[model samples]
Target: MLVASNRGPVTYSLADDGTLTSRRGGGGLVSGLSAIGAEADALWVCSALGPGDREAVRRGVGEEGVLMLAIDETVHSDAYNGIANSVLWFVHHMLYQTPLEPVFDAEFRRQWASYESYNRSFAEALADRAAEGAAVLVQDYHLALVPGMLRELRPDLRIGHFSHTPWAPVDYFRMLPDDIAARLLRGLLGADRACFLTHRWAGAFADCCRAVLGEDALATTRIGVHGLGADAGFLRERAHRPDVEERMAALRAQIGPGRRAIVRVDRTELSKNIVRGLHAYRALLATRPQWRERVTHVAFAYPSRQDLAVYRDYTAEVQRVADAINEEYGTPGWTPVVLHVKDDFARSLAAYRLADVALVNPIRDGMNLVAKEVPVVSDAGCALVLSREAGAHEELGEDAITVNPYDVIATAEALHTALTLSPEDRLATSRRLAERATALPPTRWFLDQLEALTAVG
Candidate 1:
């Protein structure tokens, strides 16, 4: 088996003292690979993101023996920021402001060429590495065109493409140039099987194919959905560690006395809706002044993609809003929003354990793992204020206080309701949600997709 993605299972970072340290990758891709990535012949192929990574690529060294693609910095930037992040990510997430963005001019065409080249590089690498009848699983929007490119290069391989983001509706997706939209659908159709995070996203992809490439395009590709669930066993064991225990004590002290915590763990990505979440918390404090001193919003907004101006601005806005709320409501004894920008996994797990409420309200998401994880680790049970837009809501909505992510007032109201939930009811609901959330562990998810790919092959 071979895995291809823009980011690898591990990345290298250089410290000020000139020592090189490596960190494993996060997210579903890495989680899914934990079961199979260590096999003797398996190779996880990925790109070089920085100078350190480029050096590693030059040395042909990586974690778990990954194959690194060392494309030129200029080409990588154009493909990553210009096309993949700017164009494709915006389109699929329904993120474009519509009037001010998405101008597909001559510059866009230049970027599109780079995007094609980047994908072709991945195809060439996979073609070189894959054995006879080997299964190639290409991940996410960054490599949508890879299946077609790899198929043209090596016809004997079994290819599958898995999308981790929501597919835009037919009308919203057409915002792209006619040629580009059709090319993407055709590219994905090159796979023998195309997978999505939910049946909703899967059906949306099928709808796009029929609308853009005609019905014949969908006949050969077997479309499927495998909603990846949390690894409960892993979470249970890890959350109980000494580090987590130390963190829980630290977080409780930070939260202060006689106050319940409202927790949210998110990157400052646009789709994550961090700004709006802060607004909701502010609104909740404003209207329901009773919760002002009693409830604290312990938001973990870790920095993400700060290189992009929009993301940087969004992160700044998040900080501004959180600060404003704290200043507005803070006293000698209490601060309203306890926002943390630094990334710390143990602290996040600690917050999970101490949370009375888990706020996961992305405007739109494939699946919000935090929604699934908090319940598994909560010490005294938790009330989940989930967004209907999040894919996990489909499975856990029955037990959660569902809200519209775009509506701050409604989300504020939902927060109040969640905060006021009966302890007995909250624990019962949290347990049930935890059970369903981890029904399919990462190993099962990987094996299922592999089994499907093998059966077809």
Candidate 2:
């Protein structure tokens, strides 16, 4: 069996002595693999992402069962940052302003070529390692073209592709150049099964296939949905650690007295809606002056993808908004918005514990785990203010205060409503959200997908 993704379970980093040390990577994919590690004879194939990773590839350091493909830095950047993150991610999330961006000129075609080459590298690696009739699972938007490339290399292999982002509707999906759009669809259709995080995303992909490849294309490949749920037991134990406890104390002091806490923990991803969320916090202050000094918005906007200019600009915008809010409503005794850009797991858990209301209002997400994780880790049963566009909303919406991600004013009102909810109701809702969120644990989710793939063979 083989698993291929742009990222892998482990990454290498250089130390002061210039020795490369490997560390386990984070994310649900890693957790899922961990669950089935004992039973499966699996090899992971990924690209060299950083300097240390490149060095590891050069030295032939195959940490765990991984095969590292060291692509040229320029090619990797064009493929990963250009085509994958900037283009495919934007189209899928509907984040592009449309008129101002995504002009797929000659440069885009060049990057598209790099994207194809990058996916092909993984395909070649998998074909080299996979046994006869082995099952191969390719992951995410970064490697959407891998299945088709791999199918060309080894048609005997049973291949499945899982998309971890929302799929664009047919109209929006056609935003790509005609050739690029057709290539992506054909690439994915080469798989025996195509999987999405939610039925909404799966249906969108199916619609696009029918629109481009005609109605009969569905008969060639099956579509599956597996909304990856949160790991409740792991979160519960980790959230209660002494490190998290220490962070909680520090956060409490920072939050101060006589003020309730409104918490948001997110990477500064474009689709996270951090800027609008901050604006909604300001709106909350403006419309309700009584709560101005009585509430603190603890925004843990951790830096993500700083390599790109757009992500850097978005991150700066988030800080600017937070500063603007503090300037507008702050006093000597009260800071309305307490924003932190550092990535701190313990601090995030602490914020989850102290939150009076947990705000997870992404413009679009495959699944916002924070919406589910917060409920499982809340010390006092925090009310959840979630975006309906989030994939997790399908499972957590009934218990959460759902709001339109694009509507800042509506979100502001929902925040207030969430904050004022009765304690009994908050507890009940939290209980329900936690229960449903953990219904499909990481192990089961991975196994279910694998089991479904076996049916394709």
* Backbone Cα, N, C clashes tallied per candidate: 0, 0
Pairs with steric clashes in candidate 1: none
Give the number of the best model, judged by TM-score: 2
lDDT of 1 by residue, 106-142 (tens): 9999999999999999999999999999998999999
Per-model TM-score, in order, reads 0.96, 0.98
**Which pairs in model 2 have colliding backbones?**
none
For model 2, residues 1-457, the per-residue Cα lDDT tens digits are: 7889888787899787889998987666677677676568888888888989988888888676788889888889999998999899999999998778879899998998999989888888899999998889999999999999899999999999999999999999998888789899989988999998888899999999889878898887999999888888888899999999999998888888867899999999999999999999999999988887888999999999998898999999999999999998999988889999999999999999888899999999998889888888898888999999999988888888989998999999999998888888888888888898898878788878888897775
Measured with C-alpha atoms, the lDDT of residue 280 in candidate 1 is: 95
Q: Give the Å shift of residue 347 in candidate 1.
A: 0.7
What is the RMSD of candidate 1?
A: 1.7
- How well does candidate 1 score on lDDT at residue 345? 92
Q: Report the poorest 10 consecutive residues by lDDT, candidate 2.
A: 30-39
* Cα RMSD for candidates in order: 1.7, 1.2
Report the Cα lDDT for candidate 2.
Answer: 0.89
